[model samples]
Target: MTRRWTHGRSMRHSGAACGATSAQARITDEAHLVTCPDCPDAAEAEAIPDDATTGDPHLIETLRDARDGHTRKIDGVVVDATTAHAILTVYDAATPKTKAKIAVLPLTVMTSLAWNILRADVKREGPR
Candidate 1:
């Protein structure tokens, strides 16, 4: 008998319960994580067709749609990252953006700060 998830959009296709492949189960689990109350989310619904180089040709479009649909609506954490394209859009003023895309630009920055904070070990404390 096939075990199934009855709640969300997908109809389960697996037969065995305990022996379902770990990788498949994980994919299904991730699909559930991306589910939307209004519509299908990343893993639940269709996305860009796979490409040879990046595996999803329309990945950028998909990400843009998701970001536009976000719930909390924070101010300007990210905006479309093009200048030439911005000329045609309403966000032209928000464009020619910076490249501060990473969560933390450098992990060791704290170590540098810590060293700078020590006042060079009092200068006279070092042996000759």
Candidate 2:
């Protein structure tokens, strides 16, 4: 028999019970068993789509510029000017930690998206 589990439901494993909300649940072959993606027994790492980053020309150029540090101030916000696309807001000029923020934003956004084109790609194809 197949059992379906809903979000916010609890499942027991190894005499220990755990509950997972919708966002914390991961899809698995065993419908009766819901596991968190971070759990040790969860599914293997997902494969990244090869074209995830290079799918859009504009996104690619913006990413390259940010990577090469061709940054400047535009309207009080730090922006990458390599392609003149102004897609990424590296930091705000008013911030005291502008330099530190610039270094951190790219790393954080590298794991996430800083602009719409990249986000759209991820939404369409799923995360990398």
Candidate 3:
């Protein structure tokens, strides 16, 4: 039995009843599977969202964060992370007196396995 999707006076598809228009349906169909990267047959060129933007403080921090907990200790510099997660401090070559506090980030967009790997410290390096 075919079902109709009618929004106004016009009758849409007579098979599947969907709220989105035909273009949206197409886009959704073509959309790449995010956080499920194991599908090797999936499209390689599709674009999607990542965890953060380039200017996001946390984004830059993650790149240079204390890898495995090795404190980035600079003399006369007191690093303090008041939040639940720890943050690393980066010193500027341009300004010897300035520091940037880059905080630990949340894993919002990663796959389950990737998140696990980030959280787990097995065969760990650096800080205890």
Candidate 4:
């Protein structure tokens, strides 16, 4: 029987869990992780660098949609908001050469969704 995700249920048993290494939930299936909206492994795979001066908190503040828990979808798949915000932080911090590499990723689809969020934030923040 193929299991479908129930909206109200937790994703802990959905074969989509991440960061927990017990053996069973380690999830080596790359394809499912790629497609699963709530997959934290996918978010971790994107891997944002921890640079002290990246100005991420400001950027995070600027992403009001992410703060509000709004959904950002990529190819009809809903992206976790914290993950999306983290991606935006990566984008904001990347160097020109590094950004070129990141811009072509499937995960970069979040950038499009983020554009609207950013514009709205800019409007609210008032006159950058």
Worst 10 residues of 3 by lDDT: 75-84
TM-score of 1: 0.19
Residue 86 in model 2: lDDT: 29
lDDT of 3 by residue, 1-71 (tens): 33222222112233222233443332223224222232221222112123344235554353344344433
RMSD of 1: 15.1
The local distance difference test score of model 1 is: 0.30
Error of 1 at 11 (Å): 12
lDDT of 4 by residue, 76-127 (tens): 2345666666666667766889666555555445465446556776799997
Model 1, 56: alpha-carbon shift in Å?
A: 1.3
Q: Report lDDT (CA) for all predictions.
A: 0.30, 0.37, 0.29, 0.47
Off by over 4 Å in 4: 1-68, 108-128
**Candidate 2, position 67, lDDT:** 47
**Using Cα atoms with residue i matched to residue i, what is each candidate's TM-score against the true structure?**
0.19, 0.22, 0.20, 0.32
- TM-score computed on alpha carbons, candidate 3: 0.20
Please give, for residues 11-111, the per-residue lDDT of candidate 2 as tens digits.
Answer: 32322223443433533446445544344322221221122132233443445564477543222223444323323443322255753444334333533
In candidate 1, what residue range of length 10 has the lowest lDDT sum? 71-80
In candidate 1, what are the lDDT values of residues 1-92, reduced to their tens digit? 43222223223334322333344442333335423342233222222222211223343343344345532111211223331122112222
User: How much is 52 displaced in model 1, in angstroms?
Assistant: 13
